[model samples]
Every structure is written in structure tokens, then in C-alpha cells.
Target: MKNRIFILSILASLGFLSSCSDSYLQEDYSDPTLISYDESTIRTNQDLQKFIRGLYSRLGTSSFSGDYFTYQELTGDLGFVSARNSGYFINTNAENHLVVDGGASSGIWSSLYNTISNANLILSYEGKVPDNPNGGVTSKALFAHAKVIRAYNYLALLGLFSPNYGEGDQSLGVPYSTTYNIEAKLPRETVPKVVDNVIADLTSSLADFESDNASAIFTNNNSFNANAIKLLLARTYLYKKDYQKAIQFADQVIDLGGELVGGGTNTGNTTFSTIFTILGENNPEILFQIEYNNIIPSNNNLQAYWGTSGAYKQNFMAKAFWDDFPSTDVRKSNVAWYQNNATTYPDDPKPINVKKYLNGPRDVILLRKTEAFFIKAEAQYHINPATAFTTLKNWVTTHRDQAYSKSLTGTAVLDEILRQKGFEFFLEGMRFTDMKRNNKAIVKVQKANNVPLGEIPVGDRRFIWPIPLSEIQTNPNIKQAPNY
Candidate 1:
């Protein structure tokens, strides 16, 4: 039975259960010949737990957890592909070669949908499984956990594949599904409708937490919990431009504790960079992270792409973006010039690479408590600008820099808040989405010319990634993004 369950996990991870075809949109999990055992295999809550672990592993894959960050940063202005390195993301750095069949588009699209399909299957066994033998993992908790994963994947898909929520209500959102119907032909939901669905899933999950007697047992930094759901709600509301609700949910996260991981002086062993090395094991600031180790190895290429000692050394921080940081800033420790003689050009100066993931097997952080502070600051700016300024000032003083005494009012306050956020989450994959949400243009920094490349104007068709050719070919109801 144990061997059968392990085989089930392996098959699910390889997409055998999600789809027999190339496109995830055509998933057919009900086909009897595909699996040796029926739904009876998942007869216990422990069995459901094992199955859900597969979904978490899928989330940790290169397509979803690893390259997704690289795609976001390279496409944005903060990072650029190095001429002295491998050919990874070269076209993406130049903002060219984004087509329907491109790997960047298809990889993220397929992986997310596959995970969602698995979550739907897990949610189907809500009441059928018996109570966990270990206790504290009720069917209700398991169902809520599945809902959070499903909603998170949908939210990620919406951010990458659809137009920004601030674009317009009628903008197209990717197809969202909640059932395991093999023959279902799902169409794209509008941005507004998708947001509504995501919110409904999260809200329903919160209710499940409230009703579950063993809810606290499941709420941890490694898995979905009430606070993680609240953080997602805050992010969704922030993207939707609903500031009041954003602030409310963000405050709930803040009130729950887990202070930011830096002090006024970053002189000690515990600094802002410690957040990455610790892997959230005992870290209070981490709300949730996708952990990777020897047993369950990480599929992300962040180490190879960003680390100076990486195998590929494919990307580096833009000089212009690096100059924005002050020497006093502790976050500067993560950015260093590539010094290896083998990779560096003797004539050309060394380029700066992010050192956040210098060693392999680093965990991918999905949500942090520090984000709540930023969200509250930004959301407060919409409601009360002066309060927002104070909020930003206090956070910077307490955590980032004690000498950070910039007195600004009006929109400048909002600008500084975003700038700090950009610094805080440089390689963690928040910059591109934040830029899109604010309708900001991408200003590429040209290395040879030392001048800014022409900005990719707001609302450019390229800003929204193309729907993969596979999905377009298989699903007639789904339409491609405009102009792609």
C-alpha cells in the first residue's frame, strides 16, 4: 500500500493523472486505465496528506517557483542578462521573442494548471477520509489547505497571464477551474470575475479554519494557514485597488506577530539577509515558504542564475538599479560583483550579481510578514498620505536604516514606500507585478550606451504574456491575450 501511494505521488508529479495530452486544459483524471487504484486509495487523512505533498512539490518546480522569479526580474528593469554568460533569458532581457509557444509562457501556464487540477482532486475527498491517526489534521483542515493552494495558483496565474487588475474590469483573466471534470472546456474569466472567484475561495477557506477544531495544528510557516490566507487576501485586495480592505487584512497579519528580521543597525549575525539563509525553520517573519533540501531537492535555478559562483551565471543586477541603494543599506550585502576569473572578462569590468542564493537548495519564499508592513504603508497612502509617510519612516528606521531620515509628503511618500519595497524584494519576484499594478513603464538600462532604453509604455500588449500555443490549440473557448 505504501509503495502504491508513492507511485501515485510520482505519477501525479509527472502529469500522468492531470492530463494524457500535452495541454493542461484537457486534463482527464477520471480515466480508469491511467491509475492502478481508484479513489479508494485515498481512504485516510494521512493518504490525503501524502497526495497534497505532491501539490506542494509541484509548486516548488522550476516552472512555478524558480524560473517564474527569474522571468519577472529579467523582464523588469532591476535585472538584466549578462553578455559574459550563458544564453538564458537573453531575449527576455531585451523584451523580445515572447510568442505563444515560448517556454517562459508555456512552462508557468502548464505547471500552475496542473497543480490546480491536483488540488481540485484533493478537495474532492473532503468528507470521505477518516480522521488523521496523528490527530490535529481534520478533513476540514485538509479541505481548507487545498482551497488555499488552489486560490494561490489561480492568483499567480492571474498575475502573470492576465492584465493587471487595475487595467480594467473587462480585461481577460486566465481560465479558473474548481472541479476534476476531464471533458470540461473552461473559458477565460474576466479580471473582475477571476478576482471575485479568488476572493471567494480564500474567504471560504478562512471560514473552514474558523470551524475546524484542530485548525491551529495546520497553521504553520511551511503550509497554508489562517495568516497565510489573510496575507493572500491582503495582496488580492491591494492588486484590486481596494485599499481599505487591503489595510484591514494586512493589519490582521501584522497583529498576529512575527516582526521584521532586521534591526536599526545591521551589525550583528542576524541581519536582513538572514531571512534567506534560515529557510524559515524558526524564523518568525516567514508566513510561508516552499522548502527544499536533500530529500526533496529544489527545482529552482536561482542559484545558477543569480549566484556569482553559479554554473550558468546568466544574469546580474542592472548598474543603474544597483546605484539606487545607499552604502549604508544592509541589503547591499546581497549584491556583489562577479569575481570568478573563469567567468569574468579581464578587459571588461565585473558585473554585479545577487548573492541571495549563493548555495544550492535554498527555499522559495512565498509570503513574508515584512510584506504586511509594505502593504499597509501603500494602502494607507491611498487613504491617508501623512499616515503613510509615518508608516514608511518608522519601518525604515526600525529595520532597514536608522539614518534614513527623508522627510517627504504627497506622492513622494508613496514613491519611497515602493522604492523600499523594491529593495526589500529584489530577487524574490515582486517588482514586475508591483510595476504592472501601478501601470508603470519598464525602463531598461543599456550597458554599452549608458542610457535608458526606450520605455515599454504602459498597457503595451507585451506586458501581458501570451497564452501558450498549446492551450490556444486545444481549448477553443480560450482566447489569446490582445495582439499576441
Candidate 2:
């Protein structure tokens, strides 16, 4: 059972050459920019820094994190592709005839594996690279950083390709490789094993940071720090249904001076819209993001795909969904009606475009503090319903809707928490995963025609993406999702 692994070749031309086994070079590579490298290229602390930068570059690409959100949005129940524009993800939007060979699965799979392999290469230098005069970054710190990247990417792979955690001991999880062994053949680990591995890597990383205060070496939100790893651990536990652990980590983040962007008020200059407006700039709420600038602009089609004007406007919000938002809600400003132009379908009438990513060359936020509040609220619901109700009500009243006074109880408290989180994270790509983990049906409405696209029932095989056909053809060990 040999599974194909796409190992990245460091940019030798850029003073870094991260290479693996010679046999891997002979094989067909998924990314053209990926060339073979020599392990000796990474000798100094500077070289190690360059190598980590390379990993971030790969992860920041549209094919990986960018499309990650896009594909989920297309498949999720939130919105649909506009018929008035370019034919992007229309079939996905309609939930029609999804095949293993199609969708964003292949690119995402290759990109993530490439990142994991490169992270492994960095981890290989754990005890070798010495602290340099330039920065006090220790080899131990670099190794911990690699572990966080590898573990986080593995978690992302699981969310896309595998069933929800705790499904069963036999439920298949994606194949995970810890070492830089391109020739190694591995079978899928169980879902629980994969979750355990993610937790172990994060826990180990946390210990390394806590022992020597190594997290101080990396201060940017783009890099993984103690809080970022904590957030990821919180999310993993939340998915695994370990409520106590989830609340534990979530609280650690919240209590550590984590504040919302708008400060829970709409009267100030720093309102909810400031999160998107100050994309590349620092925001207190953002724990982790993929930074982009004029030198190296984001390739993510978020701005183009969701833009109200121009040829690339393919996706828009459902009017019914938009109408449901209270007029006083601060988050409702994220959508605006598309003014008719030569390119638009005039008959369509009042199509709304998502404003979150309209500004290009901005940072793609992956984790933030707002999610911590939601995680704690939901986790509390399972443990103490009364406490969860207060948390939910307070969060909504303070941050989102100033006029929100819903008297929710029991299951309704949990439902409102999810609904508010969905609205908070709209177009940021948390909706589909939220629906899947909670076993909620995907109820999509057509954006153009206002037609109900039919509900994808809970636990439908379609919810689980098929293993890419390339992997199937190349790796005898790989197992496709059932009924794919």
C-alpha cells in the first residue's frame, strides 16, 4: 500500500535548497515550482528562517487556504454561484454530480502534503541548527514551529477528507507522515488516531514554548505562536466532542487579553467592518492569518469571485438569507446589493455581493479570538445549559446585534450560538464544517432564481469529499470515501 507524497523542493535560487530522497526527484511532482534540494542547504539560522518562510508561502497560496474556504462556501448551505457571471463552482453550488476527479480536492491535497513534507524537513534539523547572533531563535523553537504547521495542516486535511471525529474506531482518516520519507507507504490512520496525533504535536509544541519562552522569537500573527496553537487545539477538541478540553483551551485564549475588533460597539471608528478593512494590518482579534502585500499579492480569488462588479463576480448571497439579518446588526453590512451594469443580469434584481474580501492583497484570517467565545459558549451548552445561554446572549448583545434580546433556552441556545457564529464567519469558511460537525442538513438556496436547491441530509456521503483521483491512480494504499 504505497501512497504518493508530494515533497517540496526549496528554492535553491533563493539561497535555500530543501531536498528529500533522490527517488522523489525522479517521480512526477504536482507543483512545477517544486524542484529537488540538498539537505546541506539549511545550515544557518537564517537558512532555517528562509525555509519556514517557504512553507508559509506555499500555505498562503489560493490552492491551499484560499480555495479551502471557497470550496466549502460553494458546497455549504449558505449561498450559491450567481448565474449572471462566470461559471465557477456552479455544480458545487447546486450540489450536483460531485465526482472524485472534480472540485478543489486535488489542489488542496497536494498543497497541504507539500507543506507537511517541508515542515518535516525543518523538524529534521531539530538539534542541529545553533542559535545565531541575528535572532535568538533556537533549533528547538523552529522544531516546535514545524510541528504546529504539520499538525494544523493534518487537521485541515482531516476536516476535508474524513468523517467527523468520534464517528467510530473504524472510520478512515487520511494517511499522515511525520518524517520526510517520500518512498514510505502508509495506510489511513483511524480518525481518533489522527486527532490524537494533532493534539500530541500541539501539546509538544506548547511544552517547548513554555519551557524556554521560545514563542517570543516569533511575534507576528502570520507565524504560529502559543495562542495560535491553543486555538487550533481548542478547535480540534471541540470537533472531537471533548467539551471540557475545548473550553479549557478556549478560556486560555480569551483570558489572555483577547479582544474583539470592534470592542463590542458600533459607535466607534473601529467597527466590525474594520476587520476586513485592516486586512494586512494588525488586528487584536486575529490570532493567525496569511499575510499578503503588493510584492507578493494573494492569489485567492476571494475578491474577484465575490466582487460586486467586473467579469469575475460569480458568487453572491441569497436574498432570503440577507433579508433575515436584522437591520441593526453590525455584521449585516458585509453584503451589498450589486448595482446593475453591462455584465450583470438586469432581471436578477438586487443580487448582493460579499464585501469581506473585496479589498485585494489583504490578509486571509485563519483563526481569531471571536471563535474562542463561540467555542466556549457551545461547549458550555453541553455541560451547563444555563451558563451557555448567558454566554450566548451576552456575546450577541454586545458584539453583533445591539438590539438582540432573544429569550433562548435548551436546544435553542445552542442553535442561536451556531447561527451567530455562521453569520460572524460568513465567507470566512466555517459554515460547512460547522454544519457537518453538528450533523445539520445543508439547506442551499439558489442565488439567482431564489429556488430551494434541496437539502443535503445529514450524514450523506456527499458531505465527505472523495480522495483525489490522482491519489487513487498513483497510490494503491489510498482509500476513497465510500460511494465515491
Candidate 3:
């Protein structure tokens, strides 16, 4: 696990646009002369595969794929109540705060389009792929990879700064672009349209003819299976809030030797915190993990930001945030480790600062097995409260089916699921995203010990992030989401 990684993480954090500082901002990527055909050789799979690898390279990037946000420090290290990472920290420094737009806002905006430009070429060329005389498909590997990557790239943009799931035509999203046309000026497509396109692309990718085994889940392991593609669909469906679809895709992975891990009922050590540790993924519970070689010159995630001691002191998680965890659960250590400053914590929330993730492998776990369970629980909660209560009870219990002494129903169950989700995904760059999706509020502790309100209710617009400003200057085709 420590050794595996994609060609490289091109999507996470590289301060791509942040470095430009407006002086040469427009010049950084303006010269098309760099990637034009006449300047280099790329006409076939042999030549084109290099470009495919490049797309993976970009997805692995520190800046775009967004590794910065996951690191606790950047998110907790801020001048305000929330926090700010070097990259665009949605917690603060967003349009709401109106300051220091860490090039991330536009960097992700640009990188996705950059990857799309490459994907367009592959898709166009994919149409002419000759039928393999020996087997079922000749271009299956690259074509499938391209379409999924392209669709995913768009979704990444959408997640960063678009409105809720169904907001279409009226709500702004990335401008739909398939070609690398310098003059291409496409406004943001509606949310519904983009998601439909993403589904179509991924579905098409799954259907592609694979003459070779190019589907690799683990990077160092270097093997691509249908499982990765399937889970991506599962993830996409979850975002769409299509519970049944999420269940469908998740089922595909489980059928392919994927199973949940936990001691039967009310009795296993498996919980939120342990699931994130390195040993956690070793279990079948890991559906998908962003493999990182962690080798210096190759690929490194936001290791620098979360670096325990080499850099600045660990950006400790807020004391109050960690206090909510039950004292008996081991997951507490996984969220935030306590420090000498623990005494400074506010009294109202009364949570102990945790020491979680201080010691774990650097590879990013994108999707885990427990999430499938949580998602299933979420879908079932409203639709089938009976099943939802059962699932919720089983999940929190020491053992899988052992009835919990305490339980919830209906919205109460939904609320519990969200609370655990927050504890589970804290600082994973998901708490904010999930909160927005559920329309949860931001309960800030203006005074250290004051109990403000139950939930600080956020707006629907808060769900999507603002399109970083840098992208608008160069790509007119890109449209800023509304209310930015």
C-alpha cells in the first residue's frame, strides 16, 4: 500500500495557479505552441498512451485533485473561526470571506479543462479504432480510461463549485468543452446536464472493449479492475443522491469479492477512525484508495501540510470538534489527537481533542467500505425507516447486528448518520461538503465556552464552491457559479 500510487496525483495540490501571482497569470498556459502536433509526435496508441498517462499525472497533482484540503492544519490553520489551507480553503477565504483566493479556485477550474482537452483527442481517435483481428476490442483500455477520466474531471469541477444535484440550466456549472479550441467559449452547463454527461461517459467506459487489462486499482499494484470503474459510478450516484443507483454500483463491487468487515454484532474494533489507518485498507473494506508511492521524486500528497513535526506543529483539530466522540470508542484517537492546548477547549461542546491520523500511511483513501454501508443507511433511512434504523443500529454497535441499546428513527436516524459522518470524515475535505448537501448549519463558537445554537443552518448556494477567479480571465468559456 505504501508503495502503490497512480502515475502521479495530478488533481490534489500543486499550487498550480497560486504561484502565478497575477503578474504572469495569463502567460502561464497561453502558449499552445507547447502541446501542438507539429512540435511533438502523438498519432497512435503507442504515442497517445503517453498522453493518457499525463491525464493521470494531472489528477494526482497536489493542487487540482485537492490534497491540501484534507490535511488538518491547512483547514484548521486560519485567521478566522474555520480555517484556511494554502489551496482554496472553502472553510474560509471563499467568496463569503472575499480574500486571498488561493489559486486553487481557478487551478481546479483550469486543470479539469486541461485534462478535458486531452480526453477530447482520445475520444475522437477512439471512434476510428480498428477492430482487433485477434480479440474483441483493440482500443478498449485507453478509450475506457479516457471517458471515465473525462467524466470524472468534470464532476470534480462540479463538486467544487456547483449548486445542489438537480439545479440545472439556471444554476451554473463548468462550461461544457470537448475540444482544445483556443477560441472555444462555452458557458457553464446546467448541473443536470453535466451529471447526465458524467453518467453517460462512465457507463460508456464500463461498456468499452478491453483487449488488455488496463484497469488498475492500486498504483504500485498497477492493475485496473472493473472494481475501480464500478466504485466511481457508485460514488457518482451517491453524489447524485440516487440511492438505488448507489446501491446498484456498490453491489457490483461487493459481488466482485468485496465484502464488509466487522465482528458480527456489537463487538468489532472496526469504526470510523480505524477505517482510515493504513491497516484499515488492507481489509476488504476498502473500495477505492488513491495509492501514493510517497517516494520523494515520484508522487507525494499534501504530506507537507500534515507532516507531523518536520514543518510547523501539527495544525491541531479544534478541541470542541473532537469532544463529541464517545469516550469508549477508539475512533476518537483517529479524529484529532489531544495536546497540551486541550485545556483551552470551550466548555459548551465539551469534546476532547483527538490524536487520530497523526500516525498513518500517506496514501489517500478516496472511498472506503464503511461508506457504502453509511450510504446504504442514508438511502434506506428516509425510504425505509425500519431498515434504516436496523442499519444504523448495526453500524454503531460494537458488533454488526447486535442491537444497540439506543436507536433513532426517521429524521432522527438521518441526523445520527450525519453526526457520525462528520466524525468519520472530519478534515477529510468532506465535512463541509456533506454539511452543505444536507443543508446543515455551521455552528461556530464565537465565544470559547458559549453554546450558540443546535445547528447554524447554511444556504443551498453554499453547497457548490465558487469558480476560482483565475480561470475566468483565460477561459471565457468557463462560467462562474451564481452568487459568487
Candidate 4:
């Protein structure tokens, strides 16, 4: 008998733990039903293909549980609640990470772990693919894709739930799982250890992707491929403060022909608003994105959050972020603002809503070459500020506005890079991480509750998210984040 690896499925901490000996984990099927194999049906190419497709189906979309945009922007300085509602936005800005069973934490925790579980399931069946020279079945390709997705999901999880990774600090991070089994009782791993695990996964994934797939396959960035893995590596190393390695991996992506999304230096594509305007599979600038259409709309349509006709008009462009961009900058063109007559607070300026997620069938970018450019620029700044300045200038001039110019050195250069990053990625869900990494404060001057918004200073306890209550309740070994 094959050793059946029973799954201890924890659905977003839904607490449905199952075991191999437990009949409760097994379903009694009196008729024809789907046959699942923990180890037996690993021999067929069709089975492997089906398993891989299942994993992809579970991958989170731009909106919904795995919606990176909402989770980051709502908590950061760029977003604001124009009209208050007792929903996710309120909890997010209030720093309610301990309410693990609801809101962003619930969705993110469950969705990411679900993805991780599926990846682990595929990996459980490793070595089952035939190694035919004529390419009967490619196990390496399967493993690489699975590992890459797992690594990517874990990175996303850490970005939101864990504290900033410090070299000497031993703060806890989310549990690092390789098997979906009784090990669900495991306690949180240290941040450094989790980072190391993520790096190892990406490293193995890159080697596997390179060995199993053709270089030409990755030319299209939609799929998980070698270049995408390299981009992830770049981001991972950047977080670890390994600047040289970060630059090396980012350089690999650029060397693989990653370019900006526009048609040419200045006279190409649509107007300067092409990044937000253009959508679908043809957008050349996107390194990796989630495309949502009518056929496959399982994801949370972001339109509901920022659309003109959205249910709650709570989240809008904060005045601080809006004022940061000069009128000459092309990004300002994307902002659509209207006066709020409902409240007489804060001395009145029109609250702004971004046009990035105007409709449902839009594509959401998770990783793009533009991010790689920023990564490279930051890494360069750490090594050589002058060259970094030039790179930053060229990036803004080419894509943002022709007349934009800023000259600075030392700390100013770093500040400018992050500031520009904030504007460039406005409403794209990258601000909070940028703010944390740079040790910047979440300063807000506008009034929401009849008082000026107070600032969350750098290294505040609020920056660290609490381990979801459900996870703590279920797993006796778990500990809540400090100061929660």
C-alpha cells in the first residue's frame, strides 16, 4: 500500500484538522467521484498536469483575500477613508491585526496558506514524473513552478503580518511549512530563519526552472518562469539587506530584456497614462500581473474598493500623496477628485480617487519591470549614490514627465528614490512596505474624527501585526505579536 499522506487542512485557520487514521478526513462516496492520490497516481502526465492546473486555480487574484493593493494601500499614508464605514478599511487603518478571523488578516492568512497547501500537495508527489529524453513528463518544471508559487505566497504573507526583518532581531514570523500535515501545530519561525527558508526555496526554484524549461518560454512574463523567479530573488535579497545580491538578481532580470511598458523613450504607446490605461495580455510593460476578465472573475474586483460607483467611498487619494506629485508629473493626471460636502472638517480640499482600478476586467500587476528598475536604483544608491541619481532621473524623465528634475546626494538621494517610488506606485499597494523599510513615519495631517490625523512613528508596535487570534487559539504553541 502506498503511504497515504493525509492532509491536515487548515482553511485560513478554519480549524478542520484531519489525520490519516481519522475517518472524518475521508469522504464516503457511494458513486463516481474524483479520485485523489497522495502517492499512487503520480505516474501519469495527465494527472500531473491536472494537479498543476489545480494549484494555479488556487492562486490569489488582484482583489479578494490575496489583494495586495488593498492590504498595503489601506494601511499606508497614500490612502484615506473619505466616507467612513465599519468595514475592512476602518480595521486596517486602526491596526487591528489581532482580529485574525476577519478583515484583511483573515483573507490573507487563509488564501495564502491555501495556496501554500496546494503547492505542498503537488510536492508531496515528487519523483513521480518519468524522465524521458523525448520529454514524456517534466517533473523539474512542475517542482519549480510549485516552489516559486510557495515562495511568492510566503513573501506576501511576511510583508503584511511580520515585523521588518532585522539581522540581529529574533522577532517571530509566520510559520514556514513544507508539508501540509499534523505539523500545523508548529510555532512561528524567527524572521531571519523564515527569510533564509524563502531564499532557499527561490534558489531551488530558479535552478529547476532554468533546467526544465526553455529560455524562450519566460519571454512572456505571465507564467511563473526563470525571470520571475529572479525578480523574486532580487526582492528577497533587498529585504535581507544584501544589496549586492539584490542588484545582481535585478540585473539578471534587466539583462533578460525587461524594459519599461511604454513604446519608446517619449514618443511611444498611449499617452503617459498607459500603465493604468492599458490592460489585458498585450501590455508589454508588465513583468508579472493577474488578469481578471468575465470568464475568470473569482478574484475580488478592485473596482468595488475605489470605483466611482463603489459601495463605500471610504478609500481615496490622501492629500499628502496627491500634493507630493508635482502638477508637471504625469501621475497627477490619473487623480479624479470631487469636494466632500458631507463633512465640514479639515478646512476642505477635494478628496481624490485614483483611476487605476476603474473597472472589473482590469489587470493587477504583482511584479513588473518598473519595480525591478526601482530595486536596481535603490541597490545602486547603497553602492554608488551618483550613478543611482542618474538612473532615477532617467527613469522619471522617460516615463513620468519630460521636465521632471531633482538633484540630491547622501540621504536625500535615498529619500527621493522612496518618494518617487511612492508616487510611481500610488494605489498599486507598495507604500507601507516602502515606508517601513525606509524608517519613515506614517504621517497624516487630515482630519477624519474631528481631529488631525496623528502620525505612527517608525518602529511603533502598530507596525508589527498580531498573529491572527484563530491561529493562536488553535495552535497552543503560537504567540501573539509583541505589544498587541
For candidate 3, lDDT tens digit of each residue in 202-314?
78767752335555312332222456667777767877889889878776765655344333222232343344454444545554444433331212233333323312222
Candidate 1 residue 454 Cα shift, in angstroms, is 6.7
Q: Which has the greatest TM-score?
A: 2
The 0-to-1 C-alpha lDDT of every candidate, in the order given, reads 0.71, 0.71, 0.51, 0.64
Give per-residue lDDT, candidate 2, residue 12.
26
Candidates 1 and 4 compared: the better one by TM-score is 1
Clashes of each: 0, 1, 49, 3
lDDT of 4 by residue, 1-484 (tens): 1223222221211122222442322443233224444457556654555455445445643233226677677677766655454364665655443354556666667677867877887787777675445563376677677788888888877776787778224567888888856346877888888889999999987887777762222223545767777888999998877889998998888776535533233333333455554333445556666544454442443566663445554556666556667776656643322222333323245455556655555555677667777888898888899988888898888776677877789878888898888767766767878777767888753434543344578877666666766777789987776776
lDDT of 1 by residue, 1-484 (tens): 4434534654555342222232432444554345554578578865665566556666666365677788888777677766665767767777774788875888888878877877887777777888867676677777777888888888888887888875653558888778865456788888888898899999998878767742443223557667778989999999888999999999999898756645434433234556666343446777787756554555547877775667886676666555666666655633222222323532133455566666555566778888998999998998888999998898888776767878999988877887888768877778778877777788765332232353567988777888999888888998888888
Consecutive 10-residue window with the lowest summed lDDT within model 3: 1-10
Off by over 4 Å in 4: 1-32, 61-66, 84-88, 95-103, 131-137, 214-220, 261-272, 277-280, 333-347, 445-454
Question: In candidate 4, residue 355 scores what lDDT?
Answer: 64
Q: Order candidates by TM-score, high to low.
A: 2, 1, 4, 3
TM for every model, in the order presented, reads: 0.86, 0.87, 0.72, 0.83
